[model samples]
Target chain A: MGIISKGEWIAKDIQYRIFEQPGKFDQILSSERQLSVEYEVSRNTIRNAITILENREIIQRDGKEYRLLPTKEDFETLEIMGKQSWRTQNNVVLDTSFETNKVQSQELMQPLGTNVRKVSYIRTLADSNTPIGIETAVLPTKALDDETVANLHYQSILLFVGKQFSEAFSEEYQQVNLEHADEKMAQLLKVHRGEVVVDRHSLFVSKDNSIFVELKSSILPRFSVIVQPDQDINTKVDGFVE
Target chain B: MNNEFKAPLYIQIESLIENKIVGQEYLPGERLPGERELASTYGVNRMTVKRAINNLVSRGFLIRKQGSGTYVKSHGVGDKYYFDLAFTNEQSNAGISELLAKNGIKVSNQILGREMIVRSHFLAKKLGLSADDEIFGLHRVRNIDNEPFAVEYNYLPGSLFANAMEIDFQTIGLYDYMNSKGAQPRHVYQRIQTLRAMEKEATLLQVDKGDWLYLIQYQSADQEGRLVEYTESFLNPEKVNLKFTVVKPSI
Candidate 1:
């Protein structure tokens, strides 16, 4: 979270661009020559920053180009959520980075101590760069392929699942509630401990009613989020009140 | 209808009857099936059905006719109806009033102001009208058990809904007025995000300055695709749930 070195700040700036303007930001990082001119820094400084970004997994060198890796951003996937026009697509969260681990979760409705893949990230508002929340997605390893788990850091998780395992999930459940951010949540979201935030829990269910993945998000309560159920809304009543 | 988000039996019943009314399956002023009959239809206890009907009545979505039967109110469109009024059954969205009510919570609205005014350039663009055009503006607060949770500023174009401000918004719902004018919304686009409250907004919502609240922005069009309404609502995140249930795709 601290940025005392020049190379690190340049790396942070590059990170901000990809997260904020994903559509225009090509996955390939600018060449060292191009970056030095654009940032008005020497080639060594640009190279150092590129190295730092590479180490942070923000970008991966594919031959000569550094391809920007996908952060845990909701808008990274366009097939499932968001509007046709990017202007109205609502997930305005810019994530700094995401980390993953394997842990046994009793919460997943699976066997007593089944190992699950958990992905955690800090979410900042794209426009403001203000840390607004944290999100954790715990996946029950029993139901997913190992390939999907391996690509978690390199690709958009939601997008990958939609492309590969869309048929496996047919129903989703989400609930939003309010709670004060605890110490760990505050540290991750970059807010004061005890500040009020909106906590959301989501579960995706398989066709056979088995749990697939559970996602938990805690965000500062500064914006409204519009959502609707995709089925069985039962809007048939047609009369108006006098 | 995932099990994890499944509501209680009473809420399901409430949703059923409310859906019928909103779907126009039940006409205005028409009597609803008796509690006993509904209980049997939904396969639940009559007391539970009674609770559902009573909740709708208290919210002015329905009324009791003494010896006759429970009937749909005809004066104004209830908040629940706004959901159906704005979208087709298959793509329908639930309003905040219905969401809170489903949880067995009581919600009420207070109209702070209503007036006809010249539209600003911003309003003009949003409503797809000229800046000089006059429009009806309504300001209101929604309270949950008398605790203020949202402040809404809604606008309606004068071209489509003439003399709309003449109707008392406090006594009649906006959808009711829209329905009478043949301007029932058929399509709506909404976006939700958060904003820090200022002094005036904080005082209105009874929250501290700089506290974050949900800012919902909506633009709805009628059957002809004419923009009829644009609204901005600031809501307290404490009482609302942002639920998204994905339905099983039909084979």
Candidate 2:
């Protein structure tokens, strides 16, 4: 990564200050001279910094005063993704229904077990009750108890299983494809037949290197997936899959 | 007969042709043998060869040119460009524009509209906001040189971006504006899928109906886990190539 210039840094700091005081955002700030004096920077640097913000429309000139514009709320520190210390889990079940079936496909199982549970569900948004996507997860019955299986309806099955079995896991493989909605998918997604949709297939491996779950999700149009590879990895996968 | 492996003949034929293409035995922009010739070569019927060819065509590996034989579809590598998914900075777009400019491509945005909308159920969930909350909706057509390349729709909570509707997005990028507000995105979750252009998208993108498009959905959150913005982009598959890097664990 490249370092940002001094002017850019100063601009970001000023913007952060403005965002911190949301109640005072609309209020006119000090004069340019006063700002330059307070920041202990040269008048030219202050002017350059202010220009950066002005171009972004974070602030507008009101006569001789600069007024902060309405913008997103600020935080003291922004999280770096690859180095995230903590993750906020979305565990709330908005509104969804699930159906359980016996696993019949050998590819869905790890060792061709018969007691695998295949759960299919349609996840919907809370406010409008619009279906977001359809997900099907296959897991070994021995890995989860009856209570855990029941709770999968309200919580993410992957999270629940991870908590119960191992401390960490990674997706082994993921494949994405574009296809038209079939009759059943159209009904579930509330779209007409032949509507374009996205299909995602993932395999999750536990800490012990055992494949515990295989999940397939079909997302409606307007949703996308992004994957960032670790910098240390040798092989890089890029571009649209199909 | 290989009774143990009951794979259909058409599927096997499809893979055979697919291998040839993947292995570069049949190069892109090169014509393939006719159905009858393929059928005789593979010891399959003409109908099976036709079915296999149709499957590959639908998969974007082949193209049928009118008044000409089917040819291996060019992957459009020369015309396509790669957008970095890992970079989190103000210059990401600037860098892309500069790179494209080096290739004699001018990138510009056509601002479609900017308005305040009540948060829908889907938008509320994605942005972690309540229904009925006001949000800024910014729509733009991303043009490559003078041609439309993609159409983008971005939604930001109005509480955070109070005067967003008044700002001119054509002059500055949205991410640049957000960065100026100290709300720069540090991490993004993205999903890439394929869909056919509908009537409205077709008109906006200057493509025919049912044209395959690459749909990229992105949600960016601040370091504090607060959702900042949700964007959905419809890209012309022929013009854009979405890329990713999947890393395997060292262990």
Leading candidate by TM-score: 1
lDDT of 1 by residue, B15-76 (tens): 87877777444545556888899999989999999999999999888988655677777653
Chain A accuracy as TM-score for every candidate: 0.47, 0.50
Model 2 regions more than 4 Å off: A1-242, B1-78, B89-105, B246-251
Best model per DockQ: 1
Tens digits of lDDT, candidate 1, A45-160: 89888876664445778997667654422242242342221222123233222223222232343454555566665655445666656666666555444565455433334555
Model 1, docking class: incorrect
Q: Among these predicted structures, which one has the highest lDDT?
A: 2
